[model samples]
Target: MSGVKMNNVIKQYGEIQVIHGIDLQIKDGEFCVFVGPSGCGKSTLLRMVAGLEETTSGQMTIGTRDVTTMDPSERGVAMVFQTYALYPHMTVKENMGFGLKMNGHPKSAIEAKVAEASGILKLDEYLDRKPAALSGGQRQRVSIGRAIVRGPEVFLFDEPLSNLDAELRVEMRVEIARLHKEIGATMIYVTHDQVEAMTLADKIVVLRLGRIEQVGSPLDLYRDPDNKFVAGFIGSPAMNFLDATSGEDGVTIQALKMTAPNPIGKTSKAVTAGLRPEHLEIDPAGDALRVDLVETLGGVSFAYLVSDTGEKIVIEERGDEPVSEGQRVGLKFDAKRLYLFDAETEQRLRA
Candidate 1:
């Protein structure tokens, strides 16, 4: 396995800079995922690591070798693109062995490598099938199998499952995770999907506006986000943000108020109170809200309501007790799960 390093990397087109100076270290055999919205520079960063795009400045290394200027094929890295990229006339075996053949590897060596990768990916049954005859998941596996045959030190996946159906995507996700465990190759994946990043990564790299926002384990970022953006971006259904003003013991959120143990310092006069939907509970005898909508999802249900001050709040509830629209109800935010951030800077203010 090999690790990857990017030091003070920059990317620019003409005079406009897309990627600011960024530094990252992906450990050997670690499943590192780069996640962010479009125009966030995640793909550009990955392309730089693969040598598909030249870095405007700075150094990049794979393992102990400086590969900033090395050709993609010479860097000992393999990339699986989103589009499958398989030849229409080629069989699965041909597609998987094409790279090795081009590199002058002997026919016997190429055959052995292709057979091994096919077995690992369970593509042995489909080796004779063309791309047109395979399912989306099978096609994606072929794409990955092509990479596997290269015996690369590192694997780069560029949203390989984006085109699959929801169920197939979930299945492929598990397959990829298992492949990582079995091969133990260092992997870097890029995706805009939060759930994908949260589930697949040993470490998640969150980027925003051409710069990295934060990097940490999934739960670390979830449990303790450094800023409002990280807090809101990492969770499903997202954490709700309510405008608030800090007072003696706690902050006031319009008519609905909650108290914290310690007050935010004078440096932060105003704060935004954030509550995950799952952290907000419907309390029959608590703060009143007019239910606007309720969405049931088997084990959990989300109730959307308008607070007494007309601000929107989303609450998670359990059981079969149904909530109706336009019904006035009470809700409470779990104090322990609350997040407070500076209103101006959007940085986390208190624990």
Candidate 2:
């Protein structure tokens, strides 16, 4: 129901610092996701917002309230963690209404709120069942229902689907997305999975080594990444980086055995060329790169390749074309689609 803001927030434990100063804003009724690899401090950052982790320095506010030092119970935020954390002996209805009951709400008020949340989360049929009887997806929905019953100012989910199987993860993603749409509350979710971030986020904050890497809409980060890390981390098959150098006329990609018309020409700086797997095609006529492996995931097939220089490349096979392992091939792609990055800094080289 309210926006969240962090201004120069830092988290440190004695001598070591985990979260470097981070400043970010999540708009009201927005679904914001924090995504990064393990130990990138994504979870630490999420916990700071939830008041689960103490803020060593800086300020955090939910709506107009500065909750930097606020306790979890006082923060006006409800969190759904990776674990369900449900009471095994309590029925789904009791589990959902327990918080309200403890707060001294009348039985009628508790029942009404529990009923409302159950309807929203499609948990009505499981109301009488205990945690032992519910499926993983159903139990997780009950966990979410508990959060919904409180009607907090914001919702926090810390990789709520990590414990589920792939199919259940997909189902819960839809459930969570729908919950957000129905409630229209400010929500912050944390995950190491880029696919979830791409699918569910209105705004994504990419982090690395306790520092914020970049923030933008899912498509914006995928189409125009600020650095090699963002470009690689946002996509499924990921963007391929190859050894390249700039010369008199253009940039030469050693792995592709081709020179592209440089957007910024005539530089002697060494660079890395990035090509998305979807933008390239395997050329059977040329023998510069060899096909190492092909992975076919039904409609989409990926060809893993290695060049004479031993650089690896991954290309999504167009038209689901057949490619054999050990077949020597060449790579073809739009010259304009090529992305250049500084070799040392790994930063994008824009024209």
Whole-model lDDT per candidate? 0.88, 0.93
Among residues 3 or more apart in sequence or in different chains, the pairs in candidate 1 whose N, CA or C atoms overlap within 3 Å are none
Compose the digit string of candidate 2's lDDT tens values, residues 6-92: 999999999999999999999999999999999999999999999999999999999999999999999999999899999999999
What clash pairs does model 2 have?
none
lDDT of 1 by residue, 50-130 (tens): 999999899999999999899988899999998999998999999999999998999999999999999999999999989
Candidate that scores best on lDDT = 2
lDDT value for model 2: 0.93
Best by TM-score: 2
